[model samples]
Target: MNKIIWLFPFVLSTLYVSAQKKTDRKTLSNLQMHVAYLASDKLEGRRTGTPGEQLAAAYIAGQMKDIGLTPMGEEGFLQTFTVKEGREPAADTKMSIGDQILTPGTQFIPLPFSAASSAKGEVIPNVNEPDNIWLVNVSEMDITNPHESMANQYLKEAKEAQQAGATAVVFYNSKETAAEVAEWLDQNPAPIPVPAVWVNDAVSKKLMADDAEGFKINLQVAFKPTKRTGTNVIGYIDNKAEKTIILGAHYDHLGYGEDHNGLGTATKEIYNGADDNASGTAALLEIARLLKASKLRGNNYAIVAFSGEELGLFGSKYFTEHSQIALSQANFMINMDMVGRLTAEKGLQIGGIGTSPAWNTILPAVAPKELKLSYDSAGVGPSDHTSFYRKNIPVLFFFTGTHSDYHKPTDDAGKLNYDGALSVVKLVYDIIDKANGMDKLTFSKTREPQMGTNARFSVTLGIMPDYTFDKGGVRIDGVTDGRPASKAGMAAGDVIVQMGSLPVTNLEAYMQALGTFKKGDQTDVKVKRGNAEKVFQVQF
Candidate 1:
């Protein structure tokens, strides 16, 4: 009897494998076609807000349309969002003292916080006359505070000059002590109302040489914020159900390493990101197809191909915040990121298991016996699913482990494991099939990861620094419980401006500051929360 029972189960498993093989041929073909085009050189790595990204969006929308899925975006399967690239001085920006013209970038450059306005007035030193350009010599200014940025000191001087009735402030340093002032421009800075300019050492020497005779100054400090539009492709399958399940994948990658997020040393070559996300995106389309044609109709499906994910979850965050569909009716969210490199030995990684209690039971039951699975309970990860999880929705994230080619130009279409991607697609389909008639999953909070974790550092604040925040300092995206940041009362959205005696000007500066500290150290951390700056005592 036992032998007969085992043979019956073996025969059923064989039948299932045969049926899956028959269907996988077409699925694999679709995966190959989608990946080849999306990861092709023609798409230019599909960097968000670029022409390549637009082409990828259009292609994804066309695929959704061909699948007979309903458009769920604001504009017929296309949802647009503005992405702030950075700021740059305008082409017409110019500065002149008498007849001598100062080059915009070489001789003189507008401060990052300078107002984009023109100022014409007589230049005079040590004269704080109203409606006149004041030349401030910062060569002898006190800069003893190690925690204060030199740029901030210049800004303070400008603010003082403005308060003293100066129309515009021109800063020049004659001493070598302030030689570092040349690197003062912040890539992303908050603008001040008053116009400010910093002249190079050569220009300063020239100005000082002609200081005896006051000259009429013509200054124009104009800056334009670099921005571009990123589109998210959305498609839906309306099953006439009470709840909708969201499936998402990012289709954007680093284009020629322009974003500086690529791991490869070569920036000229395209970081195709086929395994990073093209695989996930292709898998999403296949999952959408399976769900659309499946008999399960207990819940609706919203499949989204997100852009600007490589730029810090911009697309997914925007979608969750400004969703056209009712978020209150959102049953759950599933995200696929870097799902193309799965191997039998490397296995599959499934995150957000603790997000919903149902995941513990449902995942194991639907997971294929041939596939090894690892689980991460945290709902807050470095992916799009975190956006939905933040909205109090249950979430699941699928990933095939990173390889040597991750975030490199070699992560191309040829490196993808199409069979592995197919297995993931089928696994997700089975999960959806099993949960078709179940009640809405319950959300449960899990431990957050200590983002910004570096092996060189011994201490961590236990906060996820927002990679998209360019304006100065490191912004906290999330705070882990029982960590230094959370214990110190730091919360998400707070920008860490100063750590101990070091100025946290940017993410790099923050990491460097962390290296200065050891475990079991206590220090005062300053953060800008909303319009106010607050200090917290952190114990690390």
Candidate 2:
């Protein structure tokens, strides 16, 4: 009896130590095997609903099975669905107004979903005014992103135009607006809205003159909406029925655009989303592998790789609302996005930290002391995780900050910082294993989202900023005019240097300072209007 009792303690200790080793920090390098394959050129850009995406899904499913993870859905590992492709304008279309043959890009741009319909109205005699005009009104359907999609500058502009009764937009290539728009396009080449057309300086001058005649516009513009299938590869650990833990990442990226620019060879411009997602997806697979290998189960854990995140968070949104799994059963969400760019200069950024008090206690302990971590409570931001937050699910999104490579064709597996990802994945596994072992976490009714400091305000700031901005911040995006910042003279091209009295050197600091004042509070703000810094303030 004495020997058995002694052995009992030793046996329990051995089991505990073995379980710990299953998810310890050193085992993350295992991601190398999975990430290399998933992010390889063989997967292409893994655009949602493409053969590449399906192949990735299959690989992930097979890995999950090999690691011994159970299938979560009825149809095996994939929680498959479809998304309506954005309206793509004809690439080689022609547009001309009166005497001017507008430049394809500079003078006129077609709406993505402008419909297969073409418009050729007599230049609304604006030509008699100095320029002939073709007023192409991009229909709301072709222009407006589905309400379920995350709102950005285009959506804000659409809302404003709708409110202003601005039926058509006239884009003129004067010295100013043309240059401004050119810079805008370099950063963002996504779909644009409008019954819009552009005019050259000479054309504008004619319109401005009294000799402009009855105008005529000939347009061969075309927009068509098609449906494409996207996949959400899922594998899970069946555990307690209580609250489930959702771990997700987006697996698609920019698809083929241009052809080979070298010699006589034809090379596809495939944007393999290695760091953009293959890294995160690989982490998910490795975590699933570890969990499966351990054969330890507790809270339900859903491991999913989402598609359509590049176009929008369509795959994630669809899965969150209409899932083979129950939403309420979800306790919280952890999203790993853009995690392959870890560096010593700029460490990790943890979002949604303030949403749940649990993170306050846990993340600090789980994060490594050697690295710097920035946390925020805005439980919502511009990512797939936002979809879950809107549904009231507390969420955490992990990012290693943005670089020039993000969304660019250069973002490939070759540029991924393997060691950096290894550190992050190890940290994540610690958190996941801890969350898996806990009884559902408690939540506070109100969360003060943090960017850098503890300044909490009751007001909401509306803007979808470019992810790469940090210090002397650049605003590549803006919200509707009636919103707080817009009403305060904040424009898209303006670089914000100071929000209030605080130096706005980084995103966290700016957010923290913004929290100091509430919706009704008015404050002074500084921005670079052009080459000069301008001071402006307004009542929120």
TM-score leader: 1
Misplaced by over 4 Å in model 2 are 1-30, 85-225, 257-268, 445-495, 498-540
**Candidate 2 residue-wise lDDT, 1-540, digit = tens:** 999999999999999999766655444556676677777778776777778888888888888788777787548987777676333335655777676777754565553322233445554433212222233222223434332221233344544543454434443423333333322322323433334444456656655556655556666655434457788777887765577888888877665522111111124567776787888887777766666555446667888888878766888988977787787888888899988888887688888876677887778778888987877677777678888887777788888876555554566677888778877767877787667667676654444335554455445445545454544664534444366667776777677778778777656667776777654577887877778988778566
TM-score of each: 0.70, 0.60
Residue 189 accuracy (lDDT) in model 2: 33
Query: How much is the lDDT of residue 415 in candidate 2?
Result: 81
Measured with C-alpha atoms, the lDDT of residue 71 in candidate 2 is: 82
> Superposing every Cα of model 2 onto the true structure, what RMSD results?
10.9
Which lDDT values do the candidates have, in the order given? 0.84, 0.65
Task: Report the Cα lDDT for candidate 2.
Answer: 0.65
